[model samples]
Target: MARLTVPLVLFGALIALLLVGRVTSVQAQDIEPRAFSNAPIGVNFLIAGYGYTRGGLAFDSSVPVTDPQLETSSAVLGYARVIDLWGQSGKVDVMVPYSWLSGTAESAGQPIERIVDGFADPRFRLSVNLLGAPALTLEEFRDYKQDLIVGASLQVSAPWGQYDNSRVVNLGTNRWWFKPEIGVSKAVGPWTFELAGAVTLYTENQDFLNGGTRAQEPLYSLQGHVIRGFRSGVWASLDVTHFTGGRTTINDTLNNDLQRNWRLGGTLALPVDAHNSIKLYASSGVAARTGNNFDLIGIAWQYRWGGGL
Candidate 1:
């Protein structure tokens, strides 16, 4: 009986590993912006006009169910600066978002009020460049024109906004989150592509909604951009971004993972002056399961107002 039980346990463990890989496949591939090389003691601002919608969610062994559709709009002003510590190449990023919303919905058959307000959340990041621009050779020719940056970043969230334990659209989380990230980017021809990923760790949330306790879940995203420079210092690109992730645990127990979220969008670069440009984009939430899904649109403006050192 003991020998039979040992084999069965090993089989079960193998199955669990396969399921875990399937669920985290997309989460490990998402891409995000690399703040290490973008800012070095300069101030850049990001203005976001975004929305979200959630209708039905499909969880483990469960059918799809209708959920509320909520939407919101907001503007985020963020700053990224390079911090030189220990004589290494590192940087930090900070963002404060002021949001507004207008929508009404019913959750569990109870009506909920719409909201419209402004709030702030701070993000901190640190990175170091490793092997800046590794050499590549092809057909007896070598190319080493640009720098390739690979670094790690850590971000934290602060609870300083209006949040009610029963409100789903609150702009804040009462718990702290830590995310470590890595990325690589380099310019080739007229296009520049960037790859980045981050995994988040959730601290204890005594005030989590639904009286739920959750575990650390890693979110994955990936993006690619093909830019072509036109006359007059203007450039445009077709940017494709893919994101996928779900919750890992709830109430200190592994619950059905949250529904995965997917986004599709495009960006157009508009040059304002010799050292300034603005980006406009719009994205749609393709499918959602655990909550309402909404569309998102936003604009970002960046300008270089100082030295090129």
Candidate 2:
């Protein structure tokens, strides 16, 4: 029985880690499952993935002349470690992404095309369980069962990507952005429900196109997911998200690029063994008032190691 409990606890922790890999930042609306999870401390995970996206960029009427289209492909790599903080379960992770993009747009009644390839801004996240989850060892975790969990996280994007002062559109945002989020999850039987809310704040870009300062208002986002677990360490999720209010200004001139978007997506995870898992997901914009109207598909591989410390 003791030996059986160890493998069960380890498998549960790995499933939670694989769910985290599904929440990539490749799109504006990130889909997350099991945001407030209970896993034993001192576990580490490594993830690698690829994503493809095709969409149209919606521009303000003051700048563009016609329809614009964009297609992008990216490679993602990340590392995560679970620890104990203040007697509670906590995690810290980092992600780096590189992308190649090509697009066409019409300006001044003429069609223009451009291609760019470079690294995008990297992201770091720290999350802590605030309620209903405590730091536990492997043996102690064996008897634990999840109920209601509340968690909080802070995610930051560093402005270290490829940026060109001369280009109007580049792979990088050229500014720092961060989001503070709170999440709650409840489990009943083999199903879990999760909801999370966040607001994204951006810093000024001093080197905007043609040497102008660029600023944006705060963006508000809400996300929800319904997840179901199956036999053999398999899980699936249905997810949705909405975002609004990110009006941009360049040199004090307001742009009509406020975001009011809704998206829907789903994810599936299959476990090959105790240490390896695969994730597949796809999402599309159901409604878009501004920004990009795109569809994205991604697949990831996760390898986990380490046990309780």
Candidate 3:
């Protein structure tokens, strides 16, 4: 029975690991599962991963590029720790990513292309399960079973990536962004159902497109997941997400590029042993209103320690 609990605890790391593969800011569309899951207190996780994304640049609609397609390869390093918040289960995690991209498109009826490589923005997140999950030690967790859990999270993107105002195709946004989310998770037998909602807000980019100031409206998103868990501690999930409302204004001039998009994704997590796990994931854009779409695939390896294991 103790062996059954090992992989389950590491499921939460998939949120940060899979997220590192997506686009940035308003173009960032992702599907995550097991976000509200629980783990023993004092557990630490180290993860290293690689991903490849193929899709349109999905630039802020204000840009006049057309028929844009890009292929990007990225790598990320991440860390997470489970904490105790007044008996409630809590987590804090961070990820840093680097990427290389090559693409081509047409702007104003003229052909354009770019190939670049550099560090992308880094993200940090804090999450807390407000109900159902408890902060238990490894010994106490052996008997724990999830019922219904409610959780909240806040994630921030720092503008510390490689960016140049002179180039339209750079690896960084040179702006800060924030996302606040709330979610619920319910377990029935070996199946879990999860739903979450979030809003992403962006700060002004004073140096966009060579000293051009850019601002964007808030983007709202909703996601759902269905998961199946096996006794061997392996799990698989089906995920879907929809998002809308991210129009941009450059130099105080508003643009009419409101967005509506849908995405589908899947995840498979396998625990090799008590301390190591591997995850494979893929996502694709199903529908897009403003020409923003992408198909992404990635893999990650996680190692766990502490928690008195």
Q: Write the per-residue lDDT of candidate 1 for residues 209-267, one digit (tens) a residue.
A: 66665454555555555545443434555545554554556466764546465655555
Could you give me the TM-score of model 3 versus the true structure?
Answer: 0.90
- In candidate 3, what are the lDDT values of residues 134-238, reduced to their tens digit? 998877876889899999999998998888897666677788989999999999998999999999999998998789998989999999999997776678889
Ranking by TM-score: 2, 3, 1
Better of 2 and 3 by TM-score: 2
- The digit string of per-residue lDDT tens for model 2 on 1-309 reads 988876675576455543455335564467777766877788787888888887753111112224657778879888888789999988888888888889886653677786988887888989999998898876687678889999999998888878887766566778888989999999889898999999989898888877899888898999999989775677889999998888888899887778888889898888766677888888888997864577888988887777643
Better of 1 and 2 by TM-score: 2
TM-score of 2: 0.90
Query: How does candidate 2 score on lDDT?
Result: 0.77
Preferred candidate (lDDT higher): 1 or 2: 2
Query: Local distance difference test, per candidate?
Result: 0.45, 0.77, 0.77
Candidate 1 segments exceeding 4 Å error: 1-66, 83-89, 109-111, 133-147, 209-216, 229-231, 248-254, 287-291
Question: After TM-score superposition, what is the CA distance of residue 128 in candidate 3 from its true location, in Å?
Answer: 0.5
Q: What is the lDDT of residue 72 in candidate 3?
A: 81
